[model samples]
Target: MPRRTRVLLVLFSIVTVLCAWAGLMGLGRLTNSGFLPDDAPVRDDNRRLSAHYRAGGADLVLLVRADTDVDSAAVAAQGRAVGERVARSPGVVTAVSYWSAHDPALRSRDHRAALITVDLVENEGRATRAAQDLVPGLTGRQGPVTVSATGPAWASVEGMQQSRRDLLAGELIAVPLSTLVLLFVFRSLLAALIPLLTALVSVTGTLACLYALTFVMEVSVYAANVACALGFGLAVDYGLFVVTRFREERAAGAGPDEAVTRSTRTAGRTVAVSAGIVALSLCCLFTVPLGFIRSVAVAGVLVALLSAAATVCLVPALLSAAGALLDRWDVFARLRRARATGSAGAEEGAGWRRIGRAVCRRPVLWALAATAVLLAMLLPFGHAAFAPSDARVLPAAGEAHRTQEQLRRDFAIVPDRTVTIGLPRGTDRAALDTYARAVAALPGAAEVRTADGVYRGSTHHPAPAGTAPVAAAAPAGPVLTATAASGRESAEARRFVREIRGLPAPGGSALVSGEPVRVVDTTAVLSRALPPACLLAAAVTMLVLGSFTRSVLIPLKAVAMAVLSLGACVGGMVLIFQDGHLRGLLGGFTVTGTLDGAVALFVLVVAYALSVDYELFLLSRIREEYLTTGDNTAAVIKGVQRTGRLVTAAALLVVSAMVALAASGVTLLKVIGVGLAIGVVVDATLVRGILVPALMAWAGRWNWWLPGRLRRRAATGDRHALSTDEGAEHAH
Candidate 1:
């Protein structure tokens, strides 16, 4: 065996060991989703709300009816069975169902519908367990009972579970698909396996690291899955370019040792540079305030680093070990014959090739046109409104929605908004009475009361048994409370809050905290975070590319294109999901409102980074052609033609991967997936494939222009590019 072959074997052995360890660890983290922090911003809020639910014993469940007219006994029995099961669950404190308790009016007139409330345990993991175990078990004899379980617990659990499944599925599909593509590209199974093996090693290792992270970090379920997707996707993507180049060298008849060195120096450099760009892009996720988005950014960086490692260390070793098998694909044979023919008709150029040529020939107009279209699409985003889909968060639509809705319709005196105003001890008693009177004077206000005040303006049963302590607390200033007849009259509520806020100072300030207020706050936070996040992503991209390409203007151009693509994607989502259109086509999900906070942050991160994928791919290839022969026009045409297919494939694969997420049961995941898929398609076809080349063609020398010092350095072989090219020849 050659010295190079021996070294390759050693390296492969190391990667194999590392990968095995990583697989075990990754599996452990995935299985222990509950152990992960509730890092989702929604989950964080849910945790706080769940505390209230637990304390109040206000859990919710829905009774799905097979018959429109259900009998009393059947309804009672079904409710009893479900309630009993729920009570036995880890987090359930209590259960109220038709059988356990009687509410004649609460049941549907025909007995087709009923409501149940199961108090949830305060533990986070317990909530997930209850959701998974409880709701699926609620069934009837006629048909599987459709139980929509919604509560803090179910929301947290279902979201996490669905995310985990989607990501695993993506990995399951991505690895095999990428391997197949790589095999076909190389035509040598051994050559194909090299990149796959490297990617697997990276993925396994990343998973293990993620598993370990669960102990310390609040890794979002979505983020964890996304990390795996990115790790696998990028590892294979980078390794393919490197390994293919390595095989090319071997097929060129270079000795094993020389090929290994050359492949590393060339393809290795490109991998390093590409990975750097990818890592930098992923790092931009940090700009988002939401925890899930931040987690994605963190995971993105990790995967990029892992990919870089696999391409440099792992791919080289595999190439060396494969030896002559690297070119077993008959690439050398085909190339020899092709050279002999030397005819344009024998060229691999196809429709995409022509597209590449056309794009390169008219760079500026294409770029402008694409940008305008994407910007136009983004127009709908201005009207985007985010309303939480409570149904989407739950395993099933539980009793909360129906009960709340029903209660609103029947009981006008009951407060629709459950407000919990926290105030400091010792407020003025007369002021509290004055505020109470003020609330009563409001047009829609039906009731206003402190703890001791009566809703009907008279005491019921002389404070009714258990409320005697209320008299003791009715002194001048404990914490006056009031409930409005309807939540929709937010203006009334706000007026009340303003009155309270403006009241003469007590020891501490007061805050009106409730579901409605919190929703508004979360939405506000998201809105504020978006602009900064976008700017951060742009700034980071410019900085990273500036360092790698050493051209400030090139990086700026990339950012501009990326922003346009992102805007287009957002606009499209708003039109499709927010405008209440196309719900039937997309798995019957009604677009209730704007994209949620987590998804919005996620979209910004992914769209911005993904937009750059093809831009870098095209520019790198174009730069290579330019370096080989200082002819700008020929480089643009040949480079675009050569790299276009790979970029297009990558975009399609990415879109397919994201689209697969739409199949997930969770609504938020589906939205993120669909939005990303659409964005990638538009960016790949309209922006990168057509517009980028057109812009480059228009820019000509300017695209490659750099400071004199940087231009000299760009001429010098950076280690990243040198290693990248070195591997290409060997793998051929």
Candidate 2:
């Protein structure tokens, strides 16, 4: 058996290394595009138009600033040279500039800076790579002008780089801190290492699995941050539960082998069931048609499965092999020796039982107070604004973000965000001309440049001397270069897109595509998906809990409590991240006044699963006590006493693993981390500690009521080990 275990360990090591290799390769393949569904009008139209026109809405933008007039002979010649250089670069589809086009609209309001826009290849990943390669060369001082870049491709590159840095920094802080906490909680140095090792295995495996998933479907880089963190946290959490329960069995006088068996039967089952519910919750994210949401969903499911596998298969064997040595390197020697001698058992749960009694004494008041506090946290969510991520989500001073800030402050027209009204090719010039003229008349419309000419409202102006055709249709169909317009998040840009879409085409026409339009479509799809995704997750979670407990009412109560807990967390996120409160304390991230819709959805899924995980932990102990004592109130008190510390310890481990995300430079990851940390605290204290026992006490025997068949099976010790026979199984 020892030889077999050795061989198995060797095999696991090989697989883990291979998974790491795959994950590395997968990271190279990660792309920031494909977020919008293929069928989304904006996505489809963007692709279709890119094929027809010299446009993909400018993947890279260069702001060429001259010491004086940008159009001066020297600056114009230098700027045009820069544009030509960009145009000749590999992977560049088209490049246009104020110097080359001599178009008035391309000039900044101050006339000291001019815009140089490059349209890269239609493939989003390649486009971003090309921009990344080009930005270093084009930015900084060149001949007669200083240049800086900001656009979609640059934003993508910046996001990937910052995310990598944040992930590393976060882990550095999270791992060591978590190790110390686990050392104390587990009562031994060697024992504490189990969860960390298991978490490493699960995280690497999940990353590798996610990379493989990339081949079959679109996976977002955004997904990796939350997925790996969640995988690590889950593995660590499971480790704490399984090992703690093993110690309990030993304290109860069971032999090491028997203790492993009993703990696995109890804690192992709970972890497995917890994993199933979490996986199922993540799977529900597929109902959202957006690519990012689906990517997170798939990655989360993979993490849950991998984390559960690592904890279950590896933890038990280590415990068995160590036997008497499991507590050898006791970090807390007195506590370890006391637990081993069963002396700690006397005082282990007295405090938690007292807490349970206090909460039960005023069940209604406690429940009401907890609910009200949760509701207060959720208050900020009432004003929650959802937006698509942009350079704003990056660090405040990143080149791409800084350049974007400059553009926002100085440029009258953000050409990269131009609303392109796709007019079918081969339309008559007269109809197209009319359409262009009408579009040029819209608010913030400075000039509608076309193959034929430029239009400012009803007036027609001849095309600039050297400017190539500016129409989204080479024929120029009302390409609203939103001038003096606010940012894409602003009412002006949204109104412009909305009004443009509302306009009738004079010729053959199809779609209105731009950043604002994409944001509108994304938020719309997410809004529609949120209700169904949450409902599906809730319904399925209840079913799983129902099966685990054999009590319908228990599952219902669990669902209510979990949602209430999560709602409060979401509110906290809105208050801090969106409302921009506590910015300095949270890594000094810039508040964008709105949460990324995709990130919010991901957070919701993660926090809910965690809430339910603790729910299952507490319920298992409560149900176990009730079955043994046959007194609901006593069971509630004892259950909280026995499991409260375990639940709290598990919550701490999960939080430690997640709080590393707060170390990330990226606000999105910080939001996920801090939100989850807050979530676990709420679940551990308010929901599980107070509301749970209080509600159970108020429900009395109804908490154990399981209708007809389930009650009988539960009595007979069928599946979950709730009867005396099942209890005897623990001592075997």
Candidate 3:
């Protein structure tokens, strides 16, 4: 390319990136829907039922804490005033207070703090905006009552906001750490920084892609976090591979153009295959219905492919343009020149070669040891608990988190756990009474509220004097809320949900909605979807890798390694976060005793992708060396020796991002960070460094085995590959 054209291309690229950055900034409007699918029955029912009742619990709640008993006349009067003020707010459709309704469920067990449940207008977008505008004012002093506001809308909005803040904080740390590692590995300031150029483009480009996607689909806020973090990490990865290869080729006496050509031919193929496999793995997430999971999948696949393209297209351009000036700083040369002078026999890759030989010497023993270790890591997963995230995952200072904490500590029946059952249309008075009584009679029911009244055990209390009814003309029919205090994700609460779901509908049908019901339904959805997603991910990964490497066994082995890596990582998470291990080391967050299934699946795809990423780095060299020499053991050793440092540099960059996540206050983010970092480190060091080389050595030529018919086709198809590789030696 001419100098003027190169300069023009660079300027155009910079302009494009700046626009993407601005587009990403405008994504401040991004929001995450409460961890429910768009098509969940609860959404439709709640929209209709919200018109008449605080259906599926309050969209907003004002907690009134007074100096004296909440039932005292003075406090009761103030609480009623607070409720009326909230009710008079423009968007509030209804506001029911403990004082107004005299409902036991609305009052705290200690009678110090009581709730005023507020339902907003039905349109979600307008309701959310209304809650955001109204909630801040409703909090703070209200005469004698000190009010704090929270509810489903408040928590969702707060969590989304906090997550974006943390994502910024996380990248602030991750980028520097990754750069430091790259600096050390490359040993030149420009060399270290050049790879990050690809990262800049990859991240901005992905956000631009997502911004466009938001026009057609509701993208989760978490998707941008995934795209930016993982994009930078993977972009650096491809850059490291290609830049290192170019340097090696140049060092071995190739001209600049010749070196770029060979490096792109060899290392570029690995980057393309790596991206394809990772993209294929992410594609499996479409099996899940949740927008949260599928959103991450879309962002992940986009970043992976874009990262690969950015690195391949730009790194070589920069390297060739810089020419001999690329190594000007030459920190490694300055430091090691004396050693090279003292010992002429010293050479690159000696350490990695020695390690490979050691592992290959006892292949079965090493493989078994690694297997046993990974299995031991997985033991805790058998007893692992799963749940959707609640307000507790937000920062401690957040109003929703504080409100939830107070509810858990002071209330006997958390209104948040109240499951609303939407009764079928045309329910007569008799059936409504019968269904309410039956639900109230269930073993774990805390209290049941029908349109007519409240029921506790065998007792019934008529509705407060002026409360609106579920109109007979309403298409949603009737709505009832059953408060259960067994804990939203607890076995007991879920059991209550299941039992009520099994109950015969009073008129004909019912739809359950609330915290516990959401937990149950989400868990069930993931349980059904995850297995198929994993199967598809693994099967498709094998097909992609197999076609890329022309090796049946290597792809299968790659899948096994990735699965093992993911299992061990999640098992480690179950042990630490779920089982409450090392509280001090993790910055003293609460152990929620369960993993977020959605976050787990997100981490699963990421860890699996990284595992295969390292595997491809290793396999590419081995495949190249093996074809050149037709000697399996030699190829295994040489491949490990050649690409070992490149893999380590890439692995450390990815791990740094995860480590930043581990430091977050959000327990689920911490789980992802610690778990994925540990998993990637183990895979890069132990699995890639040991088991892969050992197994390949033991398998010999079978490591590259393909059916005879396919082998012939691959040979015929790879003529250009052979021509490019004609003069390649086993080692630089």
The residue-level lDDT of candidate 1 at 477 comes to 30
> Mind giving the per-residue lDDT tens digits that candidate 1 earns over 1-732?
567657766766786688667655554343222211233233443344334322222334444443544444654566566667776776566565545544332355555655565556545445556666776556335232344444444456556655666666766666666666665566666776776776667766766666677677655566566665666556767776676566556667878777787768766776787777677766655655555566667767777788788789877777666766666755456775676587656555466668767676666667777777777788898987664344443223434334344444543322224333433446566654554455455554445444445333222212333332111232223433345544522445545444544554345444443334445545556666677766776777787777756576779888877878888888877887677566667665634455565566676677777678667767776777876677877887876676666666666556545655665556666677778877788887788777777777787788767778877787675545555554555464
TM-score, one value per model: 0.76, 0.93, 0.93
CA lDDT of each candidate?
A: 0.60, 0.80, 0.80
Better lDDT candidate (1, 3): 3
Any runs in candidate 1 off by more than 4 Å, and if so which?
A: 1-149, 167-172, 187-189, 247-260, 287-289, 327-344, 350-353, 387-417, 426-508, 580-586, 707-732
Steric clash count of candidate 1: 51
Candidate 3 regions off by >4 Å? 51-54, 71-78, 88-93, 121-127, 331-334, 337-344, 425-430, 451-478, 718-720, 727-732
